[model samples]
Target: MAGVRISRAAGALLGAAGMVVPLAVVTAAPAQAASCTTSTGPYQTRVERFLGRPVDGKQSAADCKATQKFQAQHGITPTIGYAGELTWRTMNTMLAQRAAGKTPNAAGKCPTNKGRIACVDLTRQLSWIQDGKKLTYGPVPVRTGRDGAETRTGLKKVYWRDIDHVSSLYNVSMPYSQFFDGGQAFHSVTKSMWNPPGSAGCVNMRVADAKAYWSLLRNGDDVFVYGRKPGT
Candidate 1:
């Protein structure tokens, strides 16, 4: 990753520059050897799926070249990394569009599979293993970035796991169970302020509800977080 001080996502979004979605035209020649698809990269394929297409899976030279061209046209620095920060920003912007009663740039919101992971707009949070057929916005109190630590909005995966209370890269701790990354988790936090959009990047929840969320999680549980600010 570039050591250059990349701006924290939240700040970038709140600024007047606003969020930029990928609306550029693809100009890479089909015959070019470059390829920068997500299929072979570490990023979740769901991102491409969310965008309503299948990535070539290999980051060919053509892919990189194409991406650079796309970035140059969009005025974004073309970096080669699956699910890069810009990708997250674009995804969030698209989600915001959807929340504003617009369909996502992609064809679907999320796949509806039984007991699968998903997000609930009514509750403004994500859920797991609840007969994914219906939306379950369990009243969990997750702390979101109030000062604009704005959580990346899009499809993500609980790729790793841990037992007992864990902490995030940000050093915030969650008591009594499961994985930690980026100072966030599907763990317990006080719920006195239910669904008020008051978290510092971690998903806050009532202790009891946290337990339910824990039980609901399994490695590879798909997670999606997106919605308008409460009462927008």
Candidate 2:
């Protein structure tokens, strides 16, 4: 502590003649919020439908206000009301979660022959466990990988599981992990599952869902992943 000296410009200066000189403190200003935009984004119609608004592709003042509010509520930065990629992706995930409702595998993309299998539909951001033709658990919301780090498709078996695992690479808590494909697994996160940019390839789930997964699934269980995540 004695050897560490604060420069005059950085902190209060030391007095040469035993007179103390005080420096005025400076602090960083808070960032200004983004203004709402009236521009129609590429996913305008989709955003409108998700918001329960008129499903027109045009962006009106009302639509802009609604979107801006939604973005703010969801902690989306630059909440400018544009139906951009991030906003649309978040909305899409939420819609999928709502629509799942006990029929997640209605399309039958996830093979039912595996006896008990965890099905991950990347397109709708939904995950559920099925036993033959019976719904074992879930139809819950999930957030998977982003653009370049897409969650691998096809069938994989759960190779490992940890109740309180920490990611060695990122040094973050990966609670209730059920590893299936390589480094990818199902884990719980503190943040919203639908938050933008997505995960590093693992399937992120809500705490409740992750805990349920820990209880329902075991090592060697089948995990089937299909479809393409909306943004990815």
Candidate 3:
């Protein structure tokens, strides 16, 4: 390591291009092999039940793989096949979202009087479209803005839309974008919506869901966003 250093005189040497540049060397760190564990987590049984595996609460190689796959699908961290709180919560949210499809607006939380509208329930991380009390589209799971950049709540309208929109700020593909709020819209991302630290104020949806939203909603359609996302 000591011999790797360059003296002041040699620090700025002329390159072959005739440009004086810093003489520096960098050594890449060795990459460690990813490991999988069979150690049972606290929520092992719960996870096993959710996955329809044996509810013995014991971790096996197959169980690890299954859990790891779930973690990766949901963008859970570490992806080491652990059935921790984060993973459990994601599972629960998914269950709730599925259940919501049946009676998405049963609570009468969103106004059903609107002719055709999109409703975003931040608390449940769900979105759905309705046509005067008739459920038209989802009660699908969504990823909302996280923490400081929380998705604003209020009644808004479909202000703009771009089918193959590229975000000017983030420089990412925002397909099937239906903008209802300022910089916030309903769009599709390749990422798992269940992933944490959520989206940048937009309602991130799965590919199919977004396509459905694009087909059902049009410009000037009412959009009502309310409630607060859990863990936001």
Best by TM-score: 3
Q: How much is the lDDT of residue 156 in candidate 1?
A: 63
Q: Write the per-residue lDDT of candidate 3 for residues 111-155, one digit (tens) a residue.
A: 888889999999889999989898888788888888777888999
Candidate 1 vs candidate 2: the lDDT winner is 2
lDDT tens string, model 1, 14-102? 23333211111122433323335443344335344444444755554444444445333333433443445455444454454446332
Clashing pairs in 2: none
lDDT of each: 0.43, 0.76, 0.75
Candidate 3: give the clashing pairs.
none
Flag regions of model 1 displaced more than 4 Å: 1-110, 113-115, 120-129, 135-141, 166-172, 176-183, 195-197
Comparison by TM-score, 1 against 3, better one: 3
| Alpha-carbon RMSD to native, per candidate | 18.2, 14.7, 14.1
Query: Candidate 2: lDDT over CA atoms?
Result: 0.76
The sequence of per-residue lDDT tens digits that candidate 2 reaches over residues 1-232 is 0002223432231122121111111122434667779799999999898888998799998999899888876666678899988888788678767887888888789998999999999999899999998998988888788788788899999866667665433445677877676667788876666666677678888889999999999988999999999877
Clash count, one per candidate: 23, 0, 0
User: What TM-score against the true fold does each predicted structure earn?
Assistant: 0.42, 0.77, 0.78
- Report the Cα lDDT for residue 57, model 1: 50
